[model samples]
Target: MYLRKMLFILLTFVSAVSLAACSDDENTTAATPTAKANVKVVHASQDAPGVDLLVDNTVAGTNLTFPNNTGYLQVNAGTRNVKVNVSGTSTTVIQANLNLMENKFYSVFAVNQASAIEPLVLEDNLTNPASGKAHVRFIHLSPNAPTVNITLTDGTIVFGNVAFKGSVDFTPLDAGTYNLQVRDAATNSTVVLEHS
Candidate 1:
């Protein structure tokens, strides 16, 4: 009887151990690492020379011209000190703090004249548009240009009354050739015309 009781206790203990091990496996899963953020620099100041983008005092881009963009820089998620400087010069044009979140997209714009340069942080929504559509966003970096209207060459208004240094969200357009025009809103004077 003593030997039988001892064997029964041993079997119960083994069963408990087996169940605990299975429970541990059911509770655990493979952990995924945190995603990184993406940043892009744009030179929007027309009067400023080619500029450099600095993050944490490190050069990220060099010699970017007006309306040019630095595709995307992958960075760890955190706060970053961003600076814009004239290319190859120590003269810092602007300084700002960028709070970067994981798996997000950002555009840093260097706008206005050199003496009073500014940074515009634009958070971009990277959602894919519907089929046969294109995503287009507009920025008004022309400092002296008046509030303008964007239209097709056929006078179809696209963006109405966009002021200097202002911008608009991305709108989906059909895939096709576009003759774009930027005209002064108040006087209807043509400011820019492009065939694309």
Candidate 2:
């Protein structure tokens, strides 16, 4: 009788050990890593080696490049301030924050040098497509200029005042060489015409 009792206890102990080992194997797990983010820029004219980069008013990097006028830059998942300069002139400055996702691609392009902070002379229609109804747009780029008024080659009045970073659209009244006059809204005295 004692022998049989001893045998039963040993069997129970073996079964408990086997169950414990199986439970541990099921609980084991693996981990996955986070992804990366990317950003790109495209323009009619590219930024040269002297361009500067900033993040939240902090200089992050500079002197960007791309052979095809497409510059590529990488940043962590967060917001940044993008700054560009040409030679000695800071042609333009822009502030933007991008929410980047892990392992994702992004593009931030500043095709026009005119930022909202500056005054500029805007001649909206450059291509001058003969389609009378073709649309053209102009925007001011001077920091202290306003309003856009100009006399066409024919001495016709168009656009009065445009604030800095403001825009004007022109639907060519007639298909002909129209001299564009654009001035800031504040100082109507300063106006420029794009002569074709």
Q: For candidate 1, lDDT tens digit of each residue in 44-145?
A: 776679988888999998988876889889977789898888899988889898899998989887777767889888887766766777667777776666
Worst 10 residues of 2 by lDDT: 5-14
Q: By TM-score, how accurate is candidate 1?
A: 0.78
Candidate 1 residues lying further than 4 Å off, grouped into runs, are 1-34
TM accuracy, model 2: 0.37
Candidate 1 has which clashing residue pairs, if any? none
Error of 1 at 93 (Å): 1.3
Task: State residue 108's C-alpha deviation in candidate 1, in Å.
Answer: 0.8
Q: lDDT at 122 for candidate 2?
A: 25
Specify the highest-TM-score model's number.
1
The lDDT values for all models are 0.74, 0.41
Poorly placed runs, candidate 2 (over 4 Å): 1-94, 98-130, 153-155, 170-173, 183-190
